[model samples]
Target: MAFDVDHVLAEATTEELAALVCGSGSWHTTGIPRLGVPPLRLADGPHGLRVTEQLLTQAVPATCFPTAAGLGSSWNPALLKRVGEALAHEAIALGVDVVLGPGLNIKRSPLCGRNFEYFSEDPLLSGTLSAALVYGLQSNGVGGCLKHFAVNNQETDRMRVDAVVAERTLREIYLAGFQRAVTAAAPWMVMCSYNRVNGTLASQNSWLLTDVLRGDWDYSGVVVSDWGAVYDRIAALIAGLDLEMPQAQGRAEAVAAAVEAGELSREVLEVAAERLLALTDKAASAVRPAGKIGHHDLARQAALESMVLLRNDGVLPLAPQAKVALIGAFAATPRYQGSGSSKVNPRELDRLLDTLSARCDVTYAPGFRLSGELDDDLIDEALLAAEDAEVIVACLGLPDAEEAEGFDRTHMRIPENQRALVASLSEAGKPVVVVLSNGAAVEVADWVEETSALLEAWLGGEAGALALAQVLTGEAEPSGRLTETLGLRLEDYPSALMFPGESGQVMYGEGVLVGYRGFDALEREVAFPFGFGLGYTTFRYDSLTLTDTGSVVTRDLRVAVSVTLTNTGERAGAEVVQVYVRNAPASVSRPVRELRGYTKVWLEPGETRTVIVGLGIDAFAFWSTPHERFVVESGVYAIEAGPHSRDLPLSGGLRLDVPRLPSALHDESTIAEWFADTEAMEALQARAVARTGERFALSEQMYTVVAGQPLRRFAMFPGGVLTAEDVDAVLAEYGRSV
Candidate 1:
C-alpha cells in the first residue's frame, strides 16, 4: 500500500511521466500499469456527488445537500464536517477518489453569479468552515479539492479577465482564506482558477502556484488546473502545476517534446509525475466501508440550522390549527440548487406545499410563473386563496436565469412578478410571512416592511422544504446567520463602481474593504449586517475576559477569550456568538472590526454558559508593504463580542508587546523617516549642535515644506548645519545601505 515516490520517479519513462502529468480522460487519471499506479476517478459537486454515467451524459442520483451559501450561514463548522463525511460515503460507494468542492472564494460582490458556491465575505469564516469540510472528507479516505484557487470572484469574463490587485490587498482580503485552509487542513489537491491574477494566468503564474502556495505556505499537495485552465501545458508544468485536468489531445506528446527539446527540465517532469503517482497510489489503496449511508435526516437538520429569520413581528411559529395559503410555484417545485457544474440530481426532493398540506389546513396557488412573467390570473387566484386563510405564506426567489455560472447578475431585486404577488397578498391585512429561497442576498428594503415576517431559506437542497415547514409550525427554531451583508441597493456596494471590469481586466480598487468591511468603513446602512439573525428566543451577552496563551518573543500571539451568554426568553434555541478584533489607530486603513473567532451554542430557557473562543497572531496582524510580510504593530486591541457584527454589547482590551519592525534606510530615505527613528534623530541633532552650536529643530511651516525631502538633501541646507557625513553616519549605524 505504501510505495516509494523516489523509486517510482526514477523508474518512470519520459513518455509515461508526460502521460501521468495530465488526465487520461474527462474523469480519470492516466495510470502507469508497470509501476502499479492505478487511475483515479474524479467527480463534481461540492455538496454532493455527481459521478457521470456512460458517454458522460447522465449522472447517478445522489443526496443533494445545501449549497455553500446556505451552509455558510449556519456558522457551524461541526455541521459542515458531518455533511462532508456523508458526501464522502456517497463518493466511496460510487468509486470516486477526489471530490472537487468547498469553494472558499470571498463574496466580494453579491452580483457574482457563482456566489452560491462560495462560503462567506470574510476570510476567517470561509477558511475555518472549509478546513472542517476538508478534514472530514480526507479522514473518511476521500480527497477534498479546495478551489477556484485564488480571487476567482466574478463569473463575467472569468476565463480571460485579469484580476488586478495590490499586494497588501491580495494578502489581507483575497488570499487570506486560502492561506488558512491550506495551513489548517492541508487539502489533498488545490484547483487553480481560470482567470488571471495580476497579468499572469493562474495556471502558469510561478509566483502564485510556486512562491506563495508551495514555498510560502509549505504545501506539498498536487496543484491541478481547473478544467481547461491550461493554455500552455509546458508553462504550467514549469510553474509548479502538478496536473492538468480533463482530457486533451496531443498534451502528452507535446510535454514529452518540450522536455526533449530542452524547453522543459526532466527534473520538473519527474516531480509532477511523482505526485500524480502518489495520489493514484493512495486512492487505489484506500480502505472504505462497504455499505451505503443515508443522509436525508442530516440534510434536513442542516437546512434547519441554515434558515435565517431576518425579521419577525410576533407572527412566527404559527398555530397548528391556523389556516395557511401557500403562494408561489416554487412551493410546488423548488429550485434547490444553482444551475452549473456543481448541480446534482437529487434522489428525492421535498415540496413545501405537500409538506404543509399534510400538517395543517393549507391552500396552494401558483402565484407567478417560474420565468418571472406577470400573469394577472395567477395573482388574482393567489389573492382569492388568501381571503379565507389566517396567514399568507409567500415563497419567492430569483429565477434560474438571473443567477448562474457563466455571467454576473445585473440587478439585486427579485422579479417584479414575485414582488407584485407579495404586494397583493400584503393588502389583505393578515400577517404575511415571506420566505425567500435564493442563493444570495436580494434587495428587500422597499417591500420588507410590508410583510409581518421574513425568513431567508437559501437554496437548501432536497430536504429544505421539510425544514421550512417545521420552522413555520413551531417544530424547529431558525438559527442561521448572514454570511454576506444585504445592502439597501446594489449601488451602495463599494465594489459596484468597478465590478467585473472592462478592457479585459477587473481592478480590486476598494483594497481590503469587502462586504461588511466596506459597509462598516463607509458607515453605510444595510438591510441586514453580517452575522445578523433572529431566533425564537433572545440571548444576553456579558462577562468578557481575555488571556494571553503564547509567548511574545516567539511572535506567536494567542489570546483566549471567554464570554458569558444567557437565554433570556421562554423557548429553547441556538445562537451564533461572533467575536471581532479592532486594532488601535494605525497608519494603514483597516476594517472597523474584523471577525477573529466564533462559536454556535444551544441553550434552554434561563440557561447560562460561558463560551471561550481563541484569537491567534493573524487576528491582530496586517500585511505590511514595506516589510513584504504580515506585521503586527505593538498596540492595545479591543476585543468585542455579540450576536452580530453591529450589535456588540461586550468589550475588553488587551495590550500586546510586539517587537518593532526594522526599517531599512538609505541616502534617498525621506527626512520624515529619519526623524521618526529615535536613534537617527539623536544623531542628526548632535551633528547640528556640533556644526552650528544649536540643537536640530524645524518649524511647522518649514516641516511642511521639507518633511518629504531625502536625508541626503540636508547637505544643501543653508550654513550646512547637517553635512553628508552626518547622513552617512545615521545610514551606516541605524539603517541598511541602499
Candidate 2:
C-alpha cells in the first residue's frame, strides 16, 4: 500500500514525533499504525547481513563475503556491486529495510584496528568503490547507509576523541571520500560517527551534517547516529541528525520537554518525522518474500578476487597431487572476519585443511594455539610435518584480541607465537608460502626475505579458506592489490608519533600525505606500496595518450587517457591500470603523485587491449586555504600510468590554464609573496640594503624569519626600511600585471 509521508507528519503529535525520530526497539524505529507507517529495521552489512536476536548477543545465519579491506584490494567496482546486491537480497530475506554498510572512512593509519571495515587510504579509490556498493544496494530496493560519516579513522577512544585536523587537510584527505560517496551515490542514510570532529561531536556538528552534507552536497536523506552515538537528542536534531539508534531510554521524554520549554523548535521535530516517514515510504515497495538467499557461491567468487599475491618466486600454482604441509591452527579454524558489531554469523565456513586434504596428500599440524602459551610438542609436530612434505604453507595471523573494534593496535608485528611458528617453518628446507590473515597491515620485513612466496588474505569472509586453497592449487588467479601501504616499521609512518592520540585529541600533521603518498614524499622503503599486487601472468603497458592537453578553467572539463596493455605471459590474468597525476611546480606542498583513476581488466594469453580512463578537473586540484575551495592552479600536470603508484611506466603531460585569479594582494600578505613579484623584488631589496646597510645584510635565519612576517608588520619594525606605501606600490604593480 502507498503511504503518504506528509499526512503522517501532519498527524504526528510532539510526543509521537519525538519517539519516531529515535528507535522504539533494538535496530528498529517505531511505526504509527494509525497513520499507515511501518517500522524500519536496519541490518549490519558492508559484507554480509548481521541480524541479531534478542539482546543483540546471538546473530542470525547469513552469507559472509569479503571484508571491505579485502574488497578494496580487488579494485573491481563491478564485483563490489554484485556483492552489494547479494547483501541486499539477504537483508530483504531477513525483513530488514536498510543495510548499514560501505564504510568509506580512509585508512589513515596502519594501526587502526577497524581497518578491515574501511576501504583504501586514497580517497579516489575508496570513494569510487563505495559509490558502486551504494548503487548496487539501493538498486535492489534496500537502503544503503554510508557510515562513520566523517573522521572516524581510528578505534581508540572512538566515542569522544577529537580529530584536530586542519580544514584543508580534512577537505583534501580525510573527508574527500565521504564527499564523493554522498554526491555520487546519494545513499538513503548517512551514519554519524561516534567521535568528535574539531571539538564538536559529530552528531551535533551543523557544519558537517547541515552545511556540508545536506546543503552543499544536496543530500536528501535521513542522518542517523552511530549506535549509541547520541549524547543529546534535541541538540542532535537541531544539528540535522534525524534519528538516533538502539532506543535510548528517556530520549523521547527529553525531546518533548525541550520542545515544550522552547529549547527545541517544533519544526525540527516535524522535519525529522517527515524524513523518517519518507524513508519508510521509499522502502515499502522493495520488501521481498521471506526466504533464505544462497550466497555461498558468490562469497567464494568475492574471496577469489580479494586475495592479494604480495610476493612470489615462481613457486605458486601448487600441483594438486603434490604433498603439502598445512602448518597452522588457522588452517583448521579460520579467522575469516573481524569482531564487534559487524561480525556475521556465517551460514557456512570452509576450512583450508579440509579442502586441500580432499585433493592432495596433505599433512596438517597445529603450529601453535591461537591463544595461551605455545606448546613445545605442537611446535615439534609442525616442524616434523613440514620436513616430510614437498612444500610448507604456514598460516600466520593476529589473534582476535589483538585487533578488533574497541581499540587500536599498539604495534604492527604479528603475535609473538605466530612469528615464532613462521620462523620454525621457514627452516624446513622446503618452499615456504606464508599466508597472512589480519585486519590491517603487519610487518613482514622481519621474515619476508626468507619466505618463498606471500599471500595477504586480509580477513576474507566465510569462503576465504576455499579461495585460498584455489589460489594455491591453480584453481584461481590472485588479482587483488594493496589498498594501504605495508610499511617496514611502525615508526616510519607519518602519523606514527600521534596515532591513537592522547588527552582526547589527534592531530593530522601529515596533511594530504597518507599511505603511499607519505612513503613517496619521504622516499621511504615499504614492504608493499599501495596498488601493488602480483598475478601469474605479466602485463606490458605502451602507447599512452591524452585526449585533451589544452588548458581549461572550469571544473567540468575532463581529459581522457588511453593506454595499450598486453598480456605477454602464458596465462589468463587480470591487471589494475593505475593513473597518477603529478603537479609540475606545485603551488603548495603536495604529494609527489596522487592516484586519479584506475580500472581492472582481464586478458587471455597474448591478448592486447587498449584501456581508456577519464580524468576530471578535481584530479589536478588541491584545497586552497585562501580560496576556501578546491582550486586547480594554472600549471602543467604530468599523467603517469602503470601497474601501481610506485611503478609508473608510461607518462604524458597536460597543461591546464585555470581562470582562477590570485587573491587580491593586501598589506597583511606575507613578505615572501611581495618578493615573488619579480618586478618589485629587486627594487625592494635595493632599498632595504641602502637604508639598513650592514643590518640589511641579514643571515639566512634572519631572512627566513623576516620573509614569513606579514608585509605590514615588517614595515612597522623600528629599523624597517620599507613602509606601508612601499608595500602598497608592490601590490599595485602586481594588480597591473594581472
Best TM-score goes to which candidate? 1
Q: TM-score of every model? A: 0.96, 0.94
Q: Relative to the unseen true structure, what is the C-alpha lDDT of residue 275 in candidate 1, on a scale of 0 to 100?
A: 75
Worst 10 residues of 2 by lDDT: 729-738
Best candidate according to lDDT: 1
Error of 1 at 178 (Å): 1.1
lDDT of 1: 0.89
lDDT of 2 by residue, 1-738 (tens): 569877777787888888889887778988888888889999897888888754467788999888899999999999989888888888888988899998989998989989999989999999999999998888888899999989999999999999988888888888888889889888999999999999999999999999988887899999999999999888899999999998998999999999999999999899888888888888986645454566998888888898999999988988878899988888888989998888999999999999888777899998898884668788899999987799988888887988888888889998787787777887779999989888889999999988999999988888999888899988899999999999999998888988878999998888788888888999999888889999999999998999974445544777899999999999999999999998767558888999999999999999999999998878888887766678777778899999998899999988876664554456667767665655565666666667666322457888798888877677776666776666666567653322
How high is the lDDT of residue 646 in model 1?
A: 96
lDDT values for all models? 0.89, 0.86
- Across 91-130, the per-residue lDDT of candidate 1 in tens digits comes to 8888888999889899999999999999899999999999
